[model samples]
Target: MKLQEKKELLKKTVYEMFPDAETELYHNNEFQLLIAILMSAQATDKQVNIINRNFFEFLKTPEDGLNLGVEEITEFISSVSFFNNKAKNIFKTCEILVAKHNSLPPKTIDELTELAGVGIKTAKVFLSVTEGAPYLWVDTHVHRVLNRIWIVKAKTPLGTDKIASKIFNAQDLAKLHDTLVLFGRYHCIARKPKCKTCPMLPWCSYKEKNLD
Candidate 1:
Protein backbone atom coordinates (compact mmCIF):
# COMPACT_ATOMS: atom_id res chain seq x y z
CA MET A 1 0.00 0.00 0.00
CA LYS A 2 0.99 3.64 -0.44
CA LEU A 3 2.38 5.65 2.47
CA GLN A 4 -0.75 7.79 2.69
CA GLU A 5 -2.95 4.71 2.54
CA LYS A 6 -0.99 3.07 5.31
CA LYS A 7 -1.19 6.20 7.41
CA GLU A 8 -4.91 6.41 6.83
CA LEU A 9 -5.39 2.81 7.90
CA LEU A 10 -3.25 3.27 11.01
CA LYS A 11 -5.11 6.40 12.02
CA LYS A 12 -8.49 4.80 11.41
CA THR A 13 -7.68 1.69 13.43
CA VAL A 14 -6.19 3.56 16.39
CA TYR A 15 -8.99 6.10 16.46
CA GLU A 16 -11.53 3.33 16.50
CA MET A 17 -9.66 1.52 19.22
CA PHE A 18 -9.13 4.57 21.44
CA PRO A 19 -11.62 7.26 20.64
CA ASP A 20 -11.02 8.93 23.98
CA ALA A 21 -7.23 8.86 23.84
CA GLU A 22 -5.62 11.74 25.69
CA THR A 23 -2.85 12.58 28.16
CA GLU A 24 -3.07 10.43 31.25
CA LEU A 25 -1.20 12.94 33.41
CA TYR A 26 -3.38 14.61 36.02
CA HIS A 27 -3.14 18.39 36.09
CA ASN A 28 -5.50 21.26 36.91
CA ASN A 29 -3.86 23.82 34.67
CA GLU A 30 -1.25 24.41 32.01
CA PHE A 31 1.50 25.20 34.53
CA GLN A 32 0.85 21.96 36.37
CA LEU A 33 0.67 20.07 33.09
CA LEU A 34 4.03 21.43 32.01
CA ILE A 35 5.61 20.37 35.29
CA ALA A 36 4.03 16.93 35.05
CA ILE A 37 5.42 16.47 31.54
CA LEU A 38 8.84 17.62 32.72
CA MET A 39 8.83 15.10 35.56
CA SER A 40 7.58 12.37 33.21
CA ALA A 41 10.92 12.29 31.35
CA GLN A 42 12.25 9.05 32.83
CA ALA A 43 9.03 8.35 34.69
CA THR A 44 5.57 7.11 33.76
CA ASP A 45 2.32 9.09 33.81
CA LYS A 46 1.15 6.93 36.71
CA GLN A 47 4.22 7.86 38.72
CA VAL A 48 3.89 11.54 37.89
CA ASN A 49 0.19 11.56 38.78
CA ILE A 50 0.89 9.89 42.11
CA ILE A 51 3.44 12.56 42.96
CA ASN A 52 1.29 15.39 41.65
CA ARG A 53 -1.73 14.33 43.71
CA ASN A 54 -0.22 16.04 46.74
CA PHE A 55 2.32 18.21 44.93
CA PHE A 56 -0.26 20.01 42.78
CA GLU A 57 -2.35 20.87 45.83
CA PHE A 58 0.66 22.70 47.22
CA LEU A 59 2.19 23.92 43.99
CA LYS A 60 -0.39 25.41 41.64
CA THR A 61 1.23 28.47 40.04
CA PRO A 62 4.66 29.98 39.49
CA GLU A 63 4.40 31.73 42.84
CA ASP A 64 3.50 28.43 44.42
CA GLY A 65 6.54 26.78 42.87
CA LEU A 66 8.70 29.58 44.25
CA ASN A 67 7.10 29.19 47.64
CA LEU A 68 7.81 25.44 47.67
CA GLY A 69 11.40 26.13 46.57
CA VAL A 70 13.84 23.57 45.27
CA GLU A 71 14.33 21.75 48.57
CA GLU A 72 10.63 21.38 49.25
CA ILE A 73 9.93 20.42 45.68
CA THR A 74 12.64 17.78 45.86
CA GLU A 75 11.05 16.37 48.97
CA PHE A 76 7.66 16.33 47.30
CA ILE A 77 8.90 14.54 44.21
CA SER A 78 11.64 12.47 45.81
CA SER A 79 10.18 9.30 44.35
CA VAL A 80 10.66 10.49 40.80
CA SER A 81 13.87 9.87 38.89
CA PHE A 82 16.42 12.70 38.91
CA PHE A 83 14.36 14.49 41.53
CA ASN A 84 17.14 16.90 42.49
CA ASN A 85 17.70 18.14 38.93
CA LYS A 86 13.95 18.26 38.19
CA ALA A 87 13.30 20.26 41.34
CA LYS A 88 16.01 22.77 40.50
CA ASN A 89 14.79 23.12 36.95
CA ILE A 90 11.18 23.43 38.10
CA PHE A 91 12.17 26.21 40.48
CA LYS A 92 14.12 27.98 37.76
CA THR A 93 11.25 27.54 35.29
CA CYS A 94 8.80 29.01 37.76
CA GLU A 95 11.13 31.96 38.33
CA ILE A 96 11.25 32.72 34.60
CA LEU A 97 7.49 32.32 34.19
CA VAL A 98 6.88 34.73 37.02
CA ALA A 99 9.50 37.28 36.06
CA LYS A 100 9.07 37.42 32.28
CA HIS A 101 5.96 35.58 31.12
CA ASN A 102 3.71 36.97 33.83
CA SER A 103 3.26 33.57 35.41
CA LEU A 104 1.86 31.92 32.27
CA PRO A 105 3.33 29.22 30.06
CA PRO A 106 4.49 30.37 26.66
CA LYS A 107 2.55 29.28 23.57
CA THR A 108 5.32 29.06 21.01
CA ILE A 109 7.95 26.29 20.96
CA ASP A 110 10.83 28.78 20.95
CA GLU A 111 9.53 30.69 23.95
CA LEU A 112 8.62 27.51 25.85
CA THR A 113 12.06 25.94 25.25
CA GLU A 114 13.61 29.03 26.83
CA LEU A 115 12.34 27.79 30.21
CA ALA A 116 14.49 25.55 32.33
CA GLY A 117 14.06 21.78 31.78
CA VAL A 118 11.81 22.44 28.77
CA GLY A 119 13.31 20.89 25.61
CA ILE A 120 11.90 20.62 22.11
CA LYS A 121 9.90 17.51 22.95
CA THR A 122 8.54 18.89 26.22
CA ALA A 123 7.66 22.15 24.57
CA LYS A 124 5.83 20.36 21.78
CA VAL A 125 3.88 18.21 24.24
CA PHE A 126 2.94 21.20 26.37
CA LEU A 127 1.75 23.20 23.39
CA SER A 128 -0.08 20.28 21.85
CA VAL A 129 -2.04 19.50 25.01
CA THR A 130 -2.70 23.05 26.19
CA GLU A 131 -3.11 24.92 22.91
CA GLY A 132 -4.22 22.11 20.58
CA ALA A 133 -1.16 22.79 18.49
CA PRO A 134 -0.01 20.50 15.74
CA TYR A 135 2.81 18.56 17.31
CA LEU A 136 3.57 14.86 17.72
CA TRP A 137 6.27 14.78 20.36
CA VAL A 138 7.64 11.28 19.82
CA ASP A 139 8.43 9.42 23.01
CA THR A 140 9.33 5.73 23.41
CA HIS A 141 5.79 4.45 22.80
CA VAL A 142 5.32 6.66 19.77
CA HIS A 143 8.70 5.70 18.35
CA ARG A 144 8.06 1.98 18.82
CA VAL A 145 4.52 2.12 17.33
CA LEU A 146 5.52 4.17 14.32
CA ASN A 147 8.38 1.82 13.52
CA ARG A 148 6.17 -1.24 14.01
CA ILE A 149 3.56 0.24 11.68
CA TRP A 150 6.27 1.07 9.14
CA ILE A 151 5.46 4.75 9.31
CA VAL A 152 9.09 5.58 10.06
CA LYS A 153 12.18 3.35 10.16
CA ALA A 154 14.53 5.36 12.35
CA LYS A 155 16.68 3.92 15.14
CA THR A 156 15.98 6.42 17.92
CA PRO A 157 12.89 8.36 18.94
CA LEU A 158 14.74 11.53 17.98
CA GLY A 159 15.40 10.15 14.49
CA THR A 160 11.77 9.02 14.12
CA ASP A 161 10.64 12.43 15.33
CA LYS A 162 12.67 14.11 12.58
CA ILE A 163 11.28 11.86 9.85
CA ALA A 164 7.70 12.15 11.14
CA SER A 165 7.90 15.90 10.98
CA LYS A 166 9.03 15.73 7.37
CA ILE A 167 6.41 13.20 6.24
CA PHE A 168 3.21 13.75 8.27
CA ASN A 169 1.26 16.95 7.86
CA ALA A 170 0.19 19.24 10.69
CA GLN A 171 -3.35 17.85 10.94
CA ASP A 172 -2.13 14.26 11.05
CA LEU A 173 0.38 15.11 13.76
CA ALA A 174 -2.24 16.82 15.91
CA LYS A 175 -4.79 14.05 15.47
CA LEU A 176 -2.32 11.26 16.14
CA HIS A 177 -0.67 12.89 19.13
CA ASP A 178 -2.87 11.25 21.75
CA THR A 179 -4.26 8.34 19.72
CA LEU A 180 -0.89 6.93 18.69
CA VAL A 181 0.45 7.16 22.22
CA LEU A 182 -2.54 5.29 23.60
CA PHE A 183 -2.39 2.74 20.80
CA GLY A 184 1.25 2.03 21.50
CA ARG A 185 0.88 2.13 25.24
CA TYR A 186 -2.05 -0.27 25.39
CA HIS A 187 -2.26 -2.14 22.07
CA CYS A 188 0.98 -2.23 20.11
CA ILE A 189 3.14 -2.58 23.19
CA ALA A 190 6.89 -3.10 22.98
CA ARG A 191 7.32 -6.66 24.30
CA LYS A 192 3.76 -7.93 24.11
CA PRO A 193 1.60 -6.16 21.52
CA LYS A 194 -1.96 -7.42 21.04
CA CYS A 195 -1.23 -8.20 17.43
CA LYS A 196 -3.72 -11.04 17.14
CA THR A 197 -6.65 -8.89 18.18
CA CYS A 198 -5.45 -5.62 16.70
CA PRO A 199 -7.42 -4.18 13.81
CA MET A 200 -4.25 -3.03 12.08
CA LEU A 201 -2.72 -6.51 12.22
CA PRO A 202 -3.19 -7.07 8.51
CA TRP A 203 -1.35 -3.91 7.49
CA CYS A 204 1.06 -3.69 10.42
CA SER A 205 4.70 -4.21 9.44
CA TYR A 206 6.01 -5.44 12.75
CA LYS A 207 8.12 -8.58 12.27
CA GLU A 208 8.06 -9.90 15.82
CA LYS A 209 4.45 -9.22 16.64
CA ASN A 210 3.31 -10.79 19.88
CA LEU A 211 0.50 -13.01 18.64
CA ASP A 212 0.53 -15.27 21.64
Candidate 2:
Protein backbone atom coordinates (compact mmCIF):
# COMPACT_ATOMS: atom_id res chain seq x y z
CA MET A 1 0.00 0.00 0.00
CA LYS A 2 1.08 3.58 -0.54
CA LEU A 3 2.03 5.82 2.37
CA GLN A 4 -1.21 7.77 2.30
CA GLU A 5 -3.35 4.67 2.09
CA LYS A 6 -1.33 2.99 4.81
CA LYS A 7 -1.68 6.03 7.07
CA GLU A 8 -5.43 6.19 6.55
CA LEU A 9 -5.79 2.48 7.18
CA LEU A 10 -3.64 2.67 10.32
CA LYS A 11 -5.62 5.61 11.61
CA LYS A 12 -8.99 4.01 10.95
CA THR A 13 -8.00 0.67 12.46
CA VAL A 14 -6.59 2.25 15.60
CA TYR A 15 -9.62 4.49 16.06
CA GLU A 16 -11.82 1.45 15.80
CA MET A 17 -9.71 -0.57 18.20
CA PHE A 18 -9.30 2.16 20.80
CA PRO A 19 -11.75 4.92 20.17
CA ASP A 20 -11.10 6.55 23.52
CA ALA A 21 -7.34 6.31 23.69
CA GLU A 22 -5.60 8.66 26.14
CA THR A 23 -2.35 8.96 28.04
CA GLU A 24 -1.81 6.28 30.67
CA LEU A 25 0.21 8.59 32.86
CA TYR A 26 -1.89 9.45 35.93
CA HIS A 27 -2.42 13.17 36.46
CA ASN A 28 -5.40 15.27 37.44
CA ASN A 29 -4.05 18.47 35.94
CA GLU A 30 -1.45 19.85 33.55
CA PHE A 31 1.23 20.41 36.18
CA GLN A 32 1.08 16.82 37.41
CA LEU A 33 0.99 15.57 33.86
CA LEU A 34 4.14 17.49 32.99
CA ILE A 35 5.95 16.19 36.03
CA ALA A 36 4.71 12.64 35.38
CA ILE A 37 5.91 12.72 31.78
CA LEU A 38 9.30 14.05 32.87
CA MET A 39 9.66 11.30 35.44
CA SER A 40 8.47 8.77 32.89
CA ALA A 41 11.58 9.32 30.82
CA GLN A 42 13.67 6.12 30.84
CA ALA A 43 10.93 4.61 33.00
CA THR A 44 7.61 2.88 32.47
CA ASP A 45 4.15 4.39 33.16
CA LYS A 46 3.59 1.78 35.86
CA GLN A 47 6.83 2.71 37.55
CA VAL A 48 6.08 6.41 37.35
CA ASN A 49 2.56 5.84 38.63
CA ILE A 50 3.87 3.80 41.53
CA ILE A 51 6.18 6.58 42.60
CA ASN A 52 3.78 9.43 41.78
CA ARG A 53 1.03 7.99 43.93
CA ASN A 54 3.08 8.83 46.98
CA PHE A 55 5.01 11.80 45.62
CA PHE A 56 2.22 13.73 43.88
CA GLU A 57 0.39 14.42 47.12
CA PHE A 58 3.30 16.57 48.21
CA LEU A 59 3.84 18.35 44.92
CA LYS A 60 0.87 18.97 42.71
CA THR A 61 1.68 22.49 41.54
CA PRO A 62 4.86 24.47 40.91
CA GLU A 63 4.42 26.21 44.25
CA ASP A 64 3.94 22.87 45.97
CA GLY A 65 6.98 21.41 44.22
CA LEU A 66 9.03 24.46 45.21
CA ASN A 67 8.20 23.78 48.85
CA LEU A 68 9.50 20.20 48.59
CA GLY A 69 13.27 20.30 48.78
CA VAL A 70 15.30 18.52 46.10
CA GLU A 71 16.67 16.11 48.70
CA GLU A 72 13.19 15.27 49.91
CA ILE A 73 11.95 14.83 46.36
CA THR A 74 14.90 12.56 45.64
CA GLU A 75 14.11 10.53 48.70
CA PHE A 76 10.48 10.22 47.62
CA ILE A 77 11.31 9.12 44.10
CA SER A 78 14.49 7.17 44.95
CA SER A 79 12.84 3.91 43.95
CA VAL A 80 12.48 5.15 40.37
CA SER A 81 15.23 5.12 37.79
CA PHE A 82 17.53 8.17 37.71
CA PHE A 83 15.90 9.62 40.80
CA ASN A 84 18.84 11.88 41.58
CA ASN A 85 18.85 13.59 38.23
CA LYS A 86 15.05 13.68 37.91
CA ALA A 87 14.73 15.14 41.36
CA LYS A 88 17.23 17.86 40.66
CA ASN A 89 15.58 18.71 37.37
CA ILE A 90 12.18 18.75 38.98
CA PHE A 91 13.44 21.20 41.61
CA LYS A 92 15.07 23.42 39.06
CA THR A 93 11.98 23.27 36.86
CA CYS A 94 9.78 24.30 39.76
CA GLU A 95 12.07 27.20 40.49
CA ILE A 96 11.88 28.31 36.87
CA LEU A 97 8.14 27.98 36.87
CA VAL A 98 7.74 29.93 40.06
CA ALA A 99 10.08 32.70 39.00
CA LYS A 100 9.35 33.07 35.32
CA HIS A 101 5.79 31.92 34.76
CA ASN A 102 4.51 32.84 38.22
CA SER A 103 4.03 29.21 39.23
CA LEU A 104 1.95 28.41 36.15
CA PRO A 105 2.98 25.98 33.42
CA PRO A 106 3.67 27.59 30.09
CA LYS A 107 1.41 26.67 27.20
CA THR A 108 3.80 27.10 24.30
CA ILE A 109 6.47 24.63 23.22
CA ASP A 110 9.21 27.23 23.39
CA GLU A 111 8.39 28.27 26.94
CA LEU A 112 7.80 24.70 28.07
CA THR A 113 11.16 23.50 26.74
CA GLU A 114 12.88 26.38 28.44
CA LEU A 115 12.28 24.71 31.82
CA ALA A 116 14.97 22.45 33.23
CA GLY A 117 14.77 18.75 32.22
CA VAL A 118 12.00 19.56 29.72
CA GLY A 119 12.84 18.45 26.21
CA ILE A 120 10.99 18.66 22.94
CA LYS A 121 9.20 15.41 23.64
CA THR A 122 8.16 16.48 27.13
CA ALA A 123 7.03 19.85 25.82
CA LYS A 124 5.08 18.14 23.09
CA VAL A 125 3.34 15.97 25.64
CA PHE A 126 2.30 19.02 27.64
CA LEU A 127 1.27 20.88 24.52
CA SER A 128 -0.74 18.07 23.02
CA VAL A 129 -2.37 17.00 26.25
CA THR A 130 -2.81 20.31 28.04
CA GLU A 131 -3.16 23.04 25.44
CA GLY A 132 -4.50 20.78 22.69
CA ALA A 133 -1.53 21.69 20.52
CA PRO A 134 -1.19 19.71 17.34
CA TYR A 135 2.12 17.84 17.27
CA LEU A 136 3.51 14.35 16.69
CA TRP A 137 5.18 13.76 20.03
CA VAL A 138 7.71 11.03 19.32
CA ASP A 139 8.73 8.70 22.11
CA THR A 140 10.40 5.27 21.93
CA HIS A 141 7.01 3.67 21.24
CA VAL A 142 6.18 6.23 18.54
CA HIS A 143 9.60 5.94 16.91
CA ARG A 144 9.55 2.15 16.97
CA VAL A 145 5.97 1.76 15.77
CA LEU A 146 6.20 4.39 13.03
CA ASN A 147 9.29 2.67 11.63
CA ARG A 148 7.71 -0.76 11.98
CA ILE A 149 4.54 0.34 10.23
CA TRP A 150 6.58 2.02 7.49
CA ILE A 151 4.98 5.38 8.20
CA VAL A 152 8.50 6.59 8.94
CA LYS A 153 11.90 4.95 8.40
CA ALA A 154 13.83 7.23 10.73
CA LYS A 155 16.59 5.92 13.00
CA THR A 156 15.82 8.37 15.78
CA PRO A 157 12.80 9.83 17.56
CA LEU A 158 13.56 13.34 16.28
CA GLY A 159 13.77 12.03 12.73
CA THR A 160 10.53 10.14 13.14
CA ASP A 161 8.79 13.33 14.36
CA LYS A 162 9.94 15.26 11.31
CA ILE A 163 8.89 12.52 8.90
CA ALA A 164 5.52 12.01 10.56
CA SER A 165 4.79 15.72 10.59
CA LYS A 166 5.37 15.76 6.86
CA ILE A 167 2.98 12.89 6.19
CA PHE A 168 0.28 13.55 8.80
CA ASN A 169 -1.43 16.87 9.32
CA ALA A 170 -1.36 18.71 12.64
CA GLN A 171 -4.99 17.87 13.39
CA ASP A 172 -4.22 14.15 13.27
CA LEU A 173 -1.05 14.29 15.34
CA ALA A 174 -2.46 13.77 18.84
CA LYS A 175 -4.68 10.89 17.79
CA LEU A 176 -1.89 9.36 15.74
CA HIS A 177 0.52 9.53 18.67
CA ASP A 178 -1.96 7.86 20.99
CA THR A 179 -2.82 5.21 18.41
CA LEU A 180 0.79 4.31 17.66
CA VAL A 181 1.76 4.24 21.32
CA LEU A 182 -1.14 1.88 22.06
CA PHE A 183 -0.20 -0.28 19.12
CA GLY A 184 3.46 -0.41 20.11
CA ARG A 185 2.71 -1.17 23.73
CA TYR A 186 0.01 -3.77 23.14
CA HIS A 187 0.02 -5.13 19.57
CA CYS A 188 3.04 -4.07 17.54
CA ILE A 189 5.46 -5.00 20.28
CA ALA A 190 9.24 -4.72 20.29
CA ARG A 191 9.74 -8.50 20.22
CA LYS A 192 7.31 -11.05 18.85
CA PRO A 193 4.52 -8.63 17.95
CA LYS A 194 1.06 -10.10 17.59
CA CYS A 195 1.28 -9.87 13.83
CA LYS A 196 -1.24 -12.58 13.13
CA THR A 197 -3.86 -10.69 15.15
CA CYS A 198 -2.67 -7.18 14.42
CA PRO A 199 -5.00 -4.95 12.45
CA MET A 200 -2.08 -3.22 10.74
CA LEU A 201 -0.30 -6.44 9.79
CA PRO A 202 -1.43 -6.14 6.17
CA TRP A 203 0.18 -2.72 5.88
CA CYS A 204 3.11 -3.16 8.27
CA SER A 205 6.53 -3.16 6.63
CA TYR A 206 8.22 -4.72 9.63
CA LYS A 207 5.88 -7.68 9.60
CA GLU A 208 6.30 -8.06 5.83
CA LYS A 209 10.07 -7.97 6.24
CA ASN A 210 9.83 -10.62 8.97
CA LEU A 211 11.12 -8.23 11.61
CA ASP A 212 8.23 -9.04 13.92
Q: List the candidates' TM-scores in order.
A: 0.97, 0.93
Compared with the true structure, what per-residue lDDT tens digits does model 1 show for residues 95-208? 999999999998998999999999988999988888779888888999999898898999999999999888888877876889999988888887899999988788889889
lDDT of 2 by residue, 1-212 (tens): 88889889888887887788889998887888999999999999999999888888899898887788898999999988999999999999999998999788898889999998999889988788776678878888889888988888999988988888888988998888787788778876777677777778777778444333
Off by over 4 Å in 1: none
Q: Enumerate clash totals for all models, in the order shown.
A: 0, 0
Q: Model 1 compared with the native: what TM-score?
A: 0.97
Off by over 4 Å in 2: 207-212
In model 1, the number of clashes is: 0
Evaluated at residue 43, the lDDT of candidate 2 is 94
Question: Candidate 1 clashing pairs?
Answer: none
lDDT of 2 at 12: 89
